[model samples]
Target: MAVAAAAGAVGVPAAADTQTAGAGGSQQSDIVTLDLYNLTDIHGHIEPVFDKYTSEAGLSHMACYLGKARKANPDSQFTLLGDNIGASPFTSGTQNDNPTVEALNKMGVFASTIGNHEFDKGLDVLKARIDGSDPTHYAKINFPYLGANISGMGTYLKNYRMWQSPSGVKVAFIGAIEDDVATKLFPGTVDSLTFAKPVPVINDLARELKTVGGYVTGADGSTGTEKVKADVVIAMFDNDVERSYPQMGKYVDGLMGGDTHKPYYFTKVRGAEGNILSAVASGSFTDNLANLQLKYDRKAGKVVDSAAVRIPAAEVKKCGDDPQVKAVTDAAAAKSESIKNTVITSKAGKFYRASQEDANHVKGENRGAESTLGGLIGDVMKNSFRTLDNRPIDIGVVVAGDIRSDLATDSGKITVGDVFKVMPWSNEINYVTMTGAQFQKLLEQQWKELDAKSSRPMLKLNFSSNVKYTYDPARERGQRITSVLIDGKLIDPQAKYTVAGSSFLLSGGDSFTAFGDPEVKASKRTVPNRLDREWFGQYLEKNQNVQPRKAKSSVGVSVKEEPLKDGMVKAKVSLRGLSFSGVGEPRVEKVTVKFGANSVTASVNNTLYDPNAAQYSAIVTADGIGHTDTPADVSARVRCSGRAGQTVHIPLTVENEAGTELVGAVQGLGVDVTCPAADGSVAGGGAPGAGASVSADKTPVKVNRLVRTGAGVSAILILSAGLLGMGLSLRKRKIG
Candidate 1:
């Protein structure tokens, strides 16, 4: 069902396949069908690997699949859209991705575009990989990397390349990387390179190749020109299909895109001239191989029909590994085998790195929240570094994106390969001394509104066991964090402590500018000669058995009530919960307070609180009549508005101590309270026209004198005199 066939090539015949009369009334129709094998986001995974679903994934399986497709259709040409290297596993990345390049060469990759990851190391390294100028390899790359929008870097990259099919039809492939490569890449990786607008560059190149033909300058500065024009235009981009499809589709007959790691069997977009353009993206990591078949009318000089098919990795029947590709990957695997197989430790339960479920009832792992795996990694960082450096590590932080995979084996055994896959960056462990204020600032940067208009929300940071913090998503950007405690003690804003983290963070990666400030950078000290993965492995070996601690829930609530004038009471409620601000998770739903027979609800206040504020507060007023005599017991509850739908409650009491005019003030809330009297006076005295001074410990009582003029007053006086005389006569008789 994943494969879609156009013109019924593999199924029932369709009308498009039937021959028709020519435009000039001459019967002439000849179609040339060619197959294009596309792969993207390989990430230099050379050896055979298994996915979380236990399915076969890797370049070896991909090579096998490509071989089968090529055999089935001898005219098939293998191509890589982009992201073939960089951010790779140790097997390939350790060797500068040379093994992957060698494997790709053996698999007969014709051409590819430049992905953002290709610029990970620098432009010079990328050039060396392309030209094989580095001493690692004796031969240059077999395929050319195209970048039509790239400028100012160097002349090694070509804008377009033309390949002539067996049927004598020339196909022009124009390639371009993502437009925002500069933003996504590291600080100085692409400082000298310019990524021009893709649409105009692609359109201009297409026009030149079609009208003026192909021209290139020789190595000695001699210009060589070819008068041959391309019969069909195909555009390949190293960006998301949805972002590049419409523009590329307008000019090209076929388009291929990547970067999202998703597969599109066939997506037909209408062009500017009403012509249908077909595009496809092979999935990432050899999970699936995309096959695009194009039927070209040689005489018409256009692609008449197009179809796409997705061949899953599992469907590639076991034909053993391709000997040529196997030799390359096997050599790389052999170099890493010793470390890969070495047992580091055992886990009591599975440590997840990402979401791995389909059912709604099953809760998937979130990288942005406090996760068991994150906590485990953070603990390893702190404990290992502390042991090695012989210094106290107050806190350890790790970004969720750096953690790549999960430890899902039922056997509980963990290997060096497992750790490598989880942390493939090879980043060194670094330490920086910062004040609590600066540290809190660094934590606040974790949640940011990158785009005001988009739904994409902020990322969360993972902290170690020594750090505990609460955030209120209902609050504004800098004030989201409510409370921060280090080692069970509230952090002092002026106290200085050493923090452990990756060099990436020390250098201010992920917008953590607080870590990169000159003052903070001055205190940075990297652990001598130790990588993050190595530290983790050493820690695991020493521990032998490791299990993640149960992470504390970040949601909390507190309430305070104060008595006001005219039997009115104000309840201040604070909610501490993590929300994605309408991005991934919902915001705080509502906060309600119930006291006696009255219930009141509070809404979130839009005004941002101070950075050191404890919580987001909302005030609700309720009337209290009978509460004047005794203390009022109140309960406050908060609920989240997101999918999790969790809630928290706190009980508080508003007390008016006996003999103190019954002035009420809420207690057990996280905020200070002040009560005012009903007669526009301070409850603690200091009012105008006061009669007598009242003591702090006692209530002030007043008495009124009775008037004897009224009949009721005279009757009360006569009855009181008679009762006194009778009581005296009875006493005298008893005495006699």
Candidate 2:
């Protein structure tokens, strides 16, 4: 039963009035005010912690505010939108989010819709937690989880619930999640569940409640005996208000939205008939709670007025914590303290993750770009899953969003908690073999145009040490990737290579659909039971001391051509390079051209190559070029050189010395050289050919020779003598 509250207050409404007059004057206008409060996207933040503003944020403070509000308005009904748990800190995540559920139970959360994170551990685990079926670690949720659109195997959750106000006006609440849950959740989390469109389900349920009276369905498929006839219907969705309110407003009297964590209070959503519905959303991490007061007219069976009031976390004047919530949070924190404080290893220098400043400086924009932390994690993943099922992992991919925090800048002792903060998902590593073409497509997907009107248009990806690539944002979408190298070799589009990444990528999270292709997923292999956090911890422990490596330079080329007399062509090639370190100049060692079974090495035009600007421009003159009547293919290659040295110091395991410094290998970039055909005819868009292709020989060029010193010769002689003596002893024994 819904309890109504007194409407007269001194405060102004947050938005314009969303009320309609009764059709007839004879109908009695008995108005009752129902106070509804909502909280959303807490994400298991049980204890108070410093937010970006350096102020306290936690469930305890939220509970203090809730208690105060309920005391003032005793008829208030408290609800949650969803995303109460998952992707949480060590304190809550380690305990499987039981603390959050228990805290919510104590705080008297009436009902909630399922958020994407609720299925992070899969449907079975969610069911166990909700039903308290897991005797070992489980708590019974006092409120029901409502999902009207979800069906099939996990239909145990309620679709709707009915409550009647003290004034005898009934209100029905329906819950639903976004239709795209399958893509957002971890793979296999909701494989057996079917999510239908929210509109149809919400509308049908609303109609049933308004017309023939709806009944709540039990988890065990039992029918409820209580018939629910509501004068007002409210739909609670675990989706953003921008997406849900407009589409679902006509069917329900009010809406509770979640999943973006933005606060939107008392916005009126109008229907086709000019009927206005109220909607509200509370911000994430219990930062704010919304109080929506709906004035329902029993005679007209409609809401006469609606307004919302938001209570910010800072406004909670209470200094003490809720006793019950504190008890659960304290127990969880105590268990997490040991793990959080345990030292994983030590660091010699700062390992930086991508921050707003770093992203802006690196790419001149802020979507997400590569950083030192990304590089370190990529290296760790590559080394950990180098060989799986006898297949070598050629490249390791870690998306920019996965890196949560930077390593401690002080470079002192690194703790287990530090590593957990960086890679909190605990995602398992998986390997998939993809063709070179598919790999190129995978890289292309990283640069996304989120929407037509979005101002920010880039998403950067972190790659393993062995993988390097250059992209041109100025080029077309499929043509952006100018060059790619794997294992010091050019990526051959026709060749197949095994790549390693998290299950998130393999499950097609973040819209990297190239990895989630049905054929590629069929051949995916899990790297035993190793999780990303475990691998990173082990790597840190083994390395003992680590530091950020110097960034490498990515280079590309563009060519221009002019037709000359006597069947000749002049080609001007420009090589441009961008150093990720914001330093290190690029220099071209040599340039060569290949045309129609003929190869020519160009003369050294050292004057055009600029070390300061990191660009090289040269004009190559070719005689008797494009002389043939038939179209000929033309290609050019440039060998650019750079150096990388050891940036961190670590003790050697085999010998008593520091780790060896890395020697950066020479990289190459190529472009199709354009040439005019005989009689001044341009073939295939100014490039004289049907099969003109440019490629770089990624094989490292040996610049020096190895010399065996006296010690090395002596060791070989000693090994030879030992083998000879062993053979003689065996022969003597056989003769005897």
Candidate 3:
């Protein structure tokens, strides 16, 4: 930190050092250096890290950064990627992002994408938040809130326009939030608006922006010059570039992404073919800002080149032990000290570090990062819910993606900044109701991906004494499910179940399709500001002896398979479904199946590869497996097996390997495989060989199954002579 300050002294001498001077180096006639400024996931950290009034001071610093950028170049453009609303601290959350918005508004944010948190309170409340102030309602801002790729004036606003520079250069900005925003957040937040996929939506917008002025007329009724279309495109969307950057880059010049809490800058190069594109992500976050310089060649009407600098850390003037940041921070320290000095009660003990080891939800036991940290947060969230209303949380579920860092043994000395670092994104908690069937479907999907060797889907669950579950990775993806209970009763597929989870999962974060069922809508939900901070406060209050345990492995997942090849395989396999009692327990069931498999599965587990049927398996790890009495308390591996056959009935049971049910079944497993050439001929373009077959006769016969002997397949006529003769006779009879 000291080095950064010294470097700043040499690198940034004065406020002028903040100014980004100079026109872009690329002077190509076809290039335009369009500098784009963006902000996202600020999390309402209005003050400096340690200072009391530093929050206001921090605001002034940001202003200085922005003012310098403007002074350096009047042509610079600014946009926001979202998540600037919900999950904020008391300062901004209670005030509904007013200060944050005012700050951005002051700095002239042209447009912003709607983030999932923007809908935390529902659309009406958000609308009220934005419209309450006259400046926001009637600001000179021409940029519209773009969502689902619908642009300008009509879809998000009536202005229906693109920002064109004074030199007649045009650029279109499209806004969109994560698709799951529909469910991951409260329905009240997005009451009626529907969201479409970002790619198609952006493509449609790009087309409109490219062609809006394609036709024009002169006053004399003669053909006039068409309006010059956009030379560059900026998409300020509340989606992560990590997932769709490559594809998204094709339709836009730059993607300012958010909702992931991680800062990212991506540049897409449109290939010789306008559709051909390449993209890369540039990271950004709290205390770190991405400074992007876009050099567009006005003559060429296109961006030639771009550069970005990531500010490693926030610049805050250091203070002595009584330093303001330290002072404010010390106050909390002093409280802990005073409490310790007054009474010598039983040691709270050091807070435990959660790793992939230990058992029990007990405070002293070691556990996986997700279990310990996630559980702690869930408890706090559940408490928050209780504080807000009399109704207690039925169950709390959150994906591992939401929790960025693990609690460490040394974390007992946690600081405000440290807490913010762990829960950086500050996503709001959302609730949705799903049926038992849908819940099972969601689990099946999770297993398919995780067992297939992708990322594991770990969710924090706070069950309401009514639900319990058990898992068996011992069988195949479909068969790994077992033992579900709800309200002390077995789960029923037809029953409705209430589930608590973040907006991300309900929106399919883990590819859990069942949760996205239209009927699985949200009910009572609250998007609290700074869920982690609130939880941290509660954690400190409850436990005095906090410590983190050493990390170790707990849950283990292994996949067996060969590298998979392209194409669909037709085979049936039974898969276990998850369910809870009261909601009815989900169970493993026999199923008929035919599906496509991904190549990544083969790459991960080549031994489990099925030559004929597409099959894959993988191993996943969950910490603290041994000692949990929690309802969903169990662990085992799921096995997936594939074989060559015309059709196979794979039983979905809690077993360790493929069963012997098909031991004596039919065994003529020869597969009819062919890779027809572009010319529609067999490989090598030769006549049918001994084993390979083609038509022997020129006349085509209607045959369902043709047998191959040598040279060609023996064709059997399905329309027998008798049937043909009978048909003729029927015609004759009609004539008579």
Query: Residue 208 deviation, candidate 2, in Å?
Result: 3.6
TM-score of 2: 0.64
Q: How well does each candidate superpose onto the true structure, as a TM-score?
A: 0.67, 0.64, 0.52
Model 2 local distance difference test score: 0.57
670-693 per-residue lDDT for model 2 (tens digits): 222222233322333232233322
Q: What is the lDDT of residue 607 in candidate 3?
A: 17
lDDT of 1: 0.57
The models' CA-based lDDT, in order, is 0.57, 0.57, 0.39
lDDT of 3: 0.39
Give the alpha carbon lDDT tens digit for every residue of 1-736 in model 3: 0001111422231221122223322222343445565666665544444321111223334445545554554555666666655555444444445555555555556666766666666555555555553454322223335465423213333211356543345666667655555445533445466555666666567666665642222223243355656666665556545344545634456556665443333333442236422222222223444445555666665566554433323432221121322333233334434322332213332322222210111011111122445544544444445424455554555544455433332223544444443454445566666656565555445443422222222322323323444443434344332334554454556666556655555555445556656677434354566454545555555655643222111122211211112222212121221111101111112211112211110101111111211113211122212221111111112111221111222211122122212111121111122333333333334333333322222211111212223333221111212222211111100000
Task: Name the lDDT value of residue 46 in candidate 3.
Answer: 45
- Model 2: residue 85 alpha-carbon error in angstroms: 2.7
